[model samples]
Target chain A: MPDVCKAPAAADALLEEERFQALSSGEAKIVEAAASRIFPTTDTPGAAEAGVVHYIDRTLKEIYPKQIASYREGCAALERNAKETFGRQFTELAPDQQDKILSAFEKGTASGLADASEFFALLRKHTMEGMFCEPMYGGNRGLVGWRLVGFPGQQFGYEDPYINRVVDLEPIAHEMPFSQQEALDGRKS
Target chain B: MAARADVVLVGIGAVGGILASELTAAGLKVVGLERGESPPYSDYALKDAVHAIVRHALHDSARHEPIARRDKEGENTRRRPVSSPTNQVGGALNRWTGQSNRFAPGDFKVFTQEIASGLAERAGASLEGYNVADWPIGYDDLEPYYTKYEYEMGITGADGENPFAGPRSKRFPMPPLRDTAKFVLFRDACRNLGYHPYRTPNGILSQRYKPPMPYAQGIPERPGCVYCGHCNNYGCHVHAKASTLYTHVPAALDSGNLDLRTRCKVFRINTSPDGKVTGVSYFDPAGTVQEQRASVVILGGYLYENVRLLLLSRSEASVHASGLGNTHGLVGQHIMAHEDVRVSGIFDDQIINGFIGPGSVGGRIDDFNSNNFDHTKLGFIRGATIGTSGSGTPIERYNIVPRGMPRWGADYKKYLTRYYTRSFDLNMQPETLPHKDNYVDLHPTECDAWGIPLPRVTFSLHENEQRMHRFLAGEGEKIMQATGAAKVWSAFSKRGSRWAGGTRMGTDPSNSVVNDKCQVHGIDNLFVMGASVFPTMAGYPPTATVAALTYRAADFIRSQNALFH
Candidate 1:
């Protein structure tokens, strides 16, 4: 008869930290490193700061298992190349140094990073999508990126008079349309 | 263990749902099986645009694999993979775009006459070279069934409204959908361009429908469409979209004679050594192997899986060595897809609201579709249906490039901002000719969790289709520009992409997998339904034809007492 919401602390983990801790150490590192380059420090918060690492972890855990498995392998390959080419861990390298290494690898002219350029590319692609994806995922919290792009959250209708016009709209929170809690507890407010 | 049922229907979608109820009414015990999960209408309405549309919840690409591909000659040797229709109740009907266009009269026999005549005039009048053939049945045969489907599903439209359409016995069941400003602009543009623009028929109910059945209990009452703009390739979250769930499936389930099971992946047909289908072996959701033995086995898993199952169930080494019902080695041949070309026009003075319309809620021009116009001067055998179907998603709607506009930066931004609300597009679904070269078989390299090779599509648009689509695009551009488009741009069609043809039905099994009744030629008890039975790809959206054929096949099965065969 106990309520799931009011129950005692089973754990003290924040959503993002819990998500990050769920990943393997190597996966966590590669996701963090790739997030930095994919959404590099723009006028707004980059991928790493927007919790791309946690987003990637949750996606791997919940979303497409097939794509996530391939993504992890791709990330590992890029890490191996980074260490082999520049003699540094991807996360430990300076931002400028990392950009130089990634760009050289991208142009396919890098000495040791040439063969694994596709791996780096895949990592960058995933990280960017994670950062800019619909905020239902862990990334883009508080609609930061969506606000930057003038996207209003899912209003069932475009009720605003200026909808047809090309005017920007304020950002809104991710409304979990269907709550699993309601299904499990068999209750609705 | 064998479970006895008077009627055993597979794939409870648009077709199966209708058939199940019909059989139940006639006092038969009907057991229907579907491979997808059974989610209620309310669950579908709560779908988010991102998760459901972009991510594809109804069509789980990761789990459902398409059929394989091979060259025409290698078709006999290749394995065919099963594709996705929902394993649950309602099947692919749950995610239909609701565009209901009847096939043109000439479309049924164009291969034998119009195309044949055009080819003769051009010194190439031979049906042997191309795979285009006449449909086993004609338009008259399915007219009544089409009406039944229209009324039962509460289709909205106007009869005698489409100048190019064939004669109808009665008017549509409901009035046309509410038109937006964008639809009006498209209608005006179409009319000014010397084209007849009429409201396209759709499955979305324009008004509420209350079924008469008292046993139709527990079915949720849905209001008319709210026009939330998520109609294309996404399940209607509201029950207003007249899918089988709100129509035939509920009627059948309400009948006590029926028992329905979901999440049952039918693997292969259980046939006797003499080539008669006895039952089917399927895997339940829990991976439990179960068999449903009925007098007949109906395969309605869309086009791909129907053909794949027939080929996979090949037995009797002498009878079906080249695959079941493929004695002529044409089970998976004549694969055709739509050749869709898009042309956009930007107007300086026009203020068309582009983002507030339904997906298929726009006017159509059938002037060039099928055999509506003469093609003697043109080098193409078939034509395209040019229409304006703007999904009107804000993120998706970018302005059209004018004829003399600069390419990028400030100039592009000027047009983008100015015509963002003032632009509409003309899109064409060109008829793709069936070719012997284009076929689907099994992929040699990849296999899914079920140990089945994914359907590999080895196809390319024929010269006739490519040239025809290009010509249609030009015609569309002229229409847009003449109708006060400040700027018009030419759009091109990609080769081999519409994805409709896999299991063709014809009079002769030599060129098709099924007969007029959509029954596999060699296997008396196995039936194939859906667009796979389409002998040639029509110029319009295949959803309506697929629906019409579904009703016809269900009626056929009922009249023949197929359940008790």
Candidate 2:
């Protein structure tokens, strides 16, 4: 298996074939804004910092048709709402202001922005899903979320534990977060 | 040109795949026809996970098509735009959770003893409205086949451990999977509450199998399961879960007697003037009508398609005007879907790695399932099995909160994050018996891409099933409460009737679609495979039993040799 934990360069070729670079500038900004809010850089790295926004944009272009359409609609609506309320685009809003806008939408307390609330909610849902779903999508940052939950990465058979006693399983990493692509490629060769 | 075959198998899946291998090995020529593409081993790699799991590449996207339902007035009703799209070739086996369980020995005979007896006493009630009957073959006749299925499918469980199960001659091929965090908590809690929790039987292989002899012939070297957190309703990337594609399909191909045609939508099974099957007409991928002749035919498609094929084949002036093999007008009559209910509980100190395991590897309490419990006084003839497992992903789990909790903000965040680690859930699989009124028929309003009327399922939960659902929920609540769960949220059975019945089985040709051998009555050369033939679904997953029945039916077809003439 190719190392998914490597820095984005070695897999960068594969990522290109996957069309991860196809996101327009506007689309990328919207996705970056959305991912950051859903998984802010609070306790850990936010989605944008972890490359999750890029991953989500790639997935929307590659995997799900339904998700792509919904995302496009949400992006348009969020911008319109931001322009109407704050005389600015959503991507240009201050961090605190962005948080307030998202919070109101999530809580359905947005004044004159009820429709935008649902749209933002949809954006939030998809961003978080893309950021933390299976690492096959280039998210989860080296399976960090899985590790945090103490999930043993792909071990065969738990009978050893179930039949014996409560076995505190060791966590496994399939690839490093970002520095192993060449090592994996060289090994395969 | 007519393609001749000693035996022609349709729907190269669990049952058909096994049958092809067996019949070809028995010195017979077999041609297996499949509607799905051949899935190579590499297609199940981690890279393919996105395509297979997220996109659901193999599933029927045709589920959104409009379909009509039959109501109580004997009229076709407009549907709310629904379609039953299963997997293509291996059918739903591709996306199943691999929970293999057998129906109780009594399940096969419920039509005669319970349904028949009830009709005799009830006013204006008769088996006339319903075609429910007993299976022609009994458990004793199928025990060997069940064992064979267990070995071939690499089933895992402690044999004879389930108190309610029938006596088996041998144990499971492999021991059960390790318990997930949720299962550990549930098992410990059940133990504290004085309930025995045994390992549930599943089709997932825990350890590598080295057959004493050559295991099912031509099978590829399969790796043991890697617990890749992608087993529920998703095909296993490692082929450790022994679906038909992994175990039997390749074996059949190795014999060189099987030929599969992808995207071949079967239109009808054509018959000669003498009432003997001549061949089947189907629309190939390029939209050409092609007829293939066969000495014997097997309709091993899943439940809905199997019945729909027969219904489409029926001609006017035929004795079975209702449908093919409906000489007794019982074809597509008794259709049963399982009743499912779920309950969630919150804990103050537990954060299970819910997303780290397959959907079926958990603590399943089957003591209350099927005829296992005393239901004579409860007014319900059947019961259900209660179980709990972890299938929530992180983003999804963040949204799962106790009812009435703040949807967002500091308070909501605090409560969700605190309980997210300690939250657990329990789900119930209850039996839905065949009712005369519940059936699958051609929708009067909707059509598929091929202009064939979609199968509209009209079904509802019976009063008995409702009561059983409540009973199972009550038991689960008690279990959850006893486990120190701070808060438990549960619901009674929803009133919407999606559970279908009718088209049941029995020895009598007058009431069932197929005989004990799963051969269609009157249509001696045709067989219908899948849950459609099930007399009544037991209160558990049906795929395992469906695979077992396929194996048994294939064996019956081989032994009879009624086709080679």
Candidate 3:
């Protein structure tokens, strides 16, 4: 098995086709651009660096198939707005120009296709989910989101000694998911 | 063909799970019908945010069987695609936050006290439209069963710590769990504000506990809570959270007297010509129709489903034309839900570590709960329990930003990074009075996958509850300011549906579906359990009370076993 933490390039190459399972290549690019604008990479890694597009892609395919229509229509509208405003696709626009278009989407001012505000809200919610959710869901790569927000993920217990004390501790991400089944199974026997 | 049992229990959740254990122990074979699958211990092992939060893995998917809702009675109810109560074997208990609290003395006698004190008249809110009535049984009646439930379920708490709590027969099964820094801060803040702060009682275990007597043998010994910060909205992987799935259900199964049929959705209760329930008709997992005949039928389903089942069973040809136990057209009336008001503050000076404990592991002040405070002067009759909880997971905390902060983009990210560990929410779980209009009824147009009409909830916050909310929000703001926070803000002002009442219990057969013993009036063998039997929604969480009532019902059934024949 490939090391998911170390081999970013290999993992990216393998899941390339799976990333566009619901969306076309063009649509995928639009989502990627939109996600970056929602949680852009500033001094730290935002949604784009956290593999939010991959997360949304996989979720649309496996978890939320019903949202595909909204995403498609939303992306189409976003593209229309981008072209109508800046004479460019959303993916090709400058960061500042992209921000302006996203602002319009946020305010429900951008018009052209299907429900612009609804689609913007969906993307924003999914972007956040991808950023902070456990890394097992294909986003929050290397637990960057956890580190950035100072969250210690899946720490099983904090006893009396550490309970009433406030300590500024660094974020430590668990390699394996906290298994309810394993804990329960171990006790059942 | 129909399967036969001594009792048929619908919806094996908090109440049903307890009933199954108690009745099976009393030598009555029970057949429990659960609409969802019996999730294995392994299923509890993972607390994936995507599955638990995003997809709502534990709860029944609204997409499969949506619940319709409308604020007004005349308005067309639309399908609410999210938020249905849980349906699995353990039911909502599987994913409950486990904030177990006993209803205060005043909770049972609110309506009576209101009439005596003349607060209802003074506030210009008459009891005319509001069907709020005093419970036939008081706190003393359920005290022993409350003690029994606590010890049986291994609830950890500093008993009698909340001076405002009703008299208790015994201490909590275990001592309170260790407090976090955030709770300590909140407790100190409460003290500074001249309020009594105590450990919030919860069903989650504080330490490894072996249950006593009959329940001990079959149930696995549960370890102490690890403070995984995934208690609410997530099942316990470590068997630390005392869900019915891990407690009562296992004991029932161990007795070899319970036939738990998972994925069997009971659509209708069958009754004989003499106004007696025969059993129930349900759709099995494979969509095959099946029947379970029993001497006694217990509807232990959630509050919404209980009302829906009764309304659905009503037909012009049936004995219960109005509905089961609807002699006065009262089966689905007087529904109530708690309105949660939240006040949050961001502390820039200290790291509060908001994600450190189990769901109910926090410091709470019951000084404002029930009628403990001077509600005579206040506009509202009842008040809320002000508490500070540390159940905020990473995803939930991400959304908590200071006022005027943009919801998304770079500034929002910065806000989360700065305040996620520093902010703490002070919540008020306020008591909501039951109204004649707020209720659950069968939707005319919409139906579930089984072609059964969906339950439509018609609920709106009454003026009484609205006043109570505003007062509680103001109190919360005071507490937040007392904490010396850099910034404080009220996050929750709107009332969301918490869902209670419908098939409520009382002394009168004319108004209530069930009697004090939870037996459906005029139908001796028919019963309803859970919060559905609660006439009013108390400020406290209802699961522990639901369990106690179930135990009480089981005891009543065992005593009246001769009538089963």
The numbered model that scores best in DockQ is 3
RMSD of 3: 4.1
- Compare candidates 2 and 3 on TM-score and give the better one: 3
TM-score of 2: 0.81
Q: Local error of candidate 3 at B225, Å?
A: 0.6
lDDT (Cα, tens digit) per residue for candidate 3, span B455-523: 888888877887888888888899988887889888664545456799888998877889999999998
Native-to-model Cα distance after best TM-score fit, residue B357 in candidate 1, in Å: 3.2
lDDT of 2 at B286: 85
Q: Which ten residues in a row have the lowest lDDT in candidate 2 chain A?
A: A180-189
| Best prediction by TM-score | 3
Q: Which consecutive 10 residues in model 2 chain B have the weakest lDDT in total?
A: B119-128
lDDT of model number 1: 0.65
The segments of candidate 3 whose C-alpha lies over 4 angstroms from its true place after superposition are A1-19, A160-189, B57-61, B81-84, B123-128, B214-217, B493-497
For candidate 3, the TM-score is 0.93
What's the true lDDT of residue B85 in model 1?
A: 55
Q: What is the interface RMSD of candidate 1, in Å?
A: 7.6
Task: Estimate, for each residue in A135-187, the C-alpha lDDT of model 1 and write its tens digit.
Answer: 55666554543443334545454443232354354544446522341241121
Q: What is the lDDT of residue B88 in candidate 3?
A: 79
| Chain B TM, every candidate | 0.89, 0.89, 0.97
Candidate 2 regions exceeding 4 Å error are A1-41, A46-56, A63-73, A79-121, A134-189, B47-52, B57-89, B111-137, B210-223, B317-322, B327-329, B346-351, B376-379, B391-399, B406-423, B491-503
TM-score for every candidate vs. truth? 0.80, 0.81, 0.93
